[model samples]
Target: MTSNAENELLERYGWPIEEMDFGREDDPDVIGCAVLEEVEGGTSGIFVVRPGLDEENRTGFAEWAVQRVGRYFEHGPEPDGWQKRSDGGWQLWVRRVEMPPI
Candidate 1:
């Protein structure tokens, strides 16, 4: 079962519940939440949540995200940091990682 916090996160991030695939490594999906800073060169970080893996192995996904997203920022949270996967859900990190280099 997904907690209220998870549901709220989904809503805030615009991630559709139907699109989430939990415990299915063959098909993985990424859900991201970002906050743009008004200041120039200011830091902006996004919390990414993924689904489609077993609870025990979900942390791996988080670690992968941290490494992939951390490249954009000068520093970021440790790779070990991650909330447990609930109801076929996991989270990743994205900071100042934008596309098209706006």
Candidate 2:
């Protein structure tokens, strides 16, 4: 589920921001959410974009985004970084963030 505000924010982007339920309905604290590519039983309904960069420079935007987001999470394993594959692909190995005990 998603809140009205989240939907509104996502609506500004249009395509690729598919209807996803991140387990946050009316919770304001659920400010950060993403539709990642590596999840099991995934949906092709999701995607990514480097809106701040030009098409030519978006080569590693996904990796960059992962490292950037890792900086703010409450808890994550060490060595959070991005890697480039030999096949001209990029991957970001992120840690499972530890959420606060509610």
Candidate 3:
């Protein structure tokens, strides 16, 4: 189940369904993290990162989070693109593994 805020975003952004909690960063400035897995037909996962402070633009928090995930997780997805949310957060798309056809 998604939070009310998330639900609003889902409607507003037309995001893909089926999101998973990928966990948060240890950085004190970052919070409310999750990953929308297998987006775009399993080609990518989207990183949802909420910062503790108010950010006006793409302040590299998404990139920093991506780097952190890469260092902690083995063979993590690579960053494809990102966007600053209206609520002062960020959503980053990362490349995911491709599955074989059935």
Candidate 4:
């Protein structure tokens, strides 16, 4: 299941639930959440510029996203940062982050 914070991240990016094949009426957290790709320890998701949105805005949203790995999260730009794949999807690096539990 996706936490509220995770769902908020997707909504901020204008994530296309339907186009991504995960309907809003369904459980969209597990499959579409900003989760760590177990094999590579990375994260991936699709972002759309909607009808009124511009490319710049979409790109900004992508960069703003953070990948959640259980209780940890990772985010950055280029070289060792998150970036949009050639296919227009965004993927985060496999840099595991650890923080003291609150």
Clashes of each: 6, 0, 0, 0
lDDT of 1 by residue, 1-102 (tens): 554444553454433233232333543333333232223555333443444435433443344334444443434333434333343223443222236864
* Candidate 4 local lDDT, 47-68, one digit each (tens): 3222333344333333434333
TM-score order of candidates, top first = 1, 3, 4, 2
Give me the displacement of residue 76 in model 1, in angstroms: 13
For model 3, residues 2-51, the per-residue Cα lDDT tens digits are: 44444444454453233234444444334334343433443233445443
Query: Which structure is stronger by TM-score: 1 or 2?
Result: 1
lDDT value for model 2: 0.35
| Candidate 2 residue-wise lDDT, 1-102, digit = tens | 433433433453332322233444455233222332222552112333322333322323333333443442434322444344464333343222448999
* Full-model lDDT for every candidate: 0.38, 0.35, 0.40, 0.37
The candidate that wins on lDDT is 3
Clashing residue pairs in candidate 2 are none
Model 4: CA > 4 A from native: 16-76, 83-90, 93-102
Q: Report how far residue 3 has shifted in candidate 3, in Å.
A: 26
At residue 2, give the lDDT of candidate 1.
Answer: 50
Candidate 4 residue pairs in backbone clash = none
Descending-lDDT candidate ranking = 3, 1, 4, 2
Candidate with top TM-score is 1
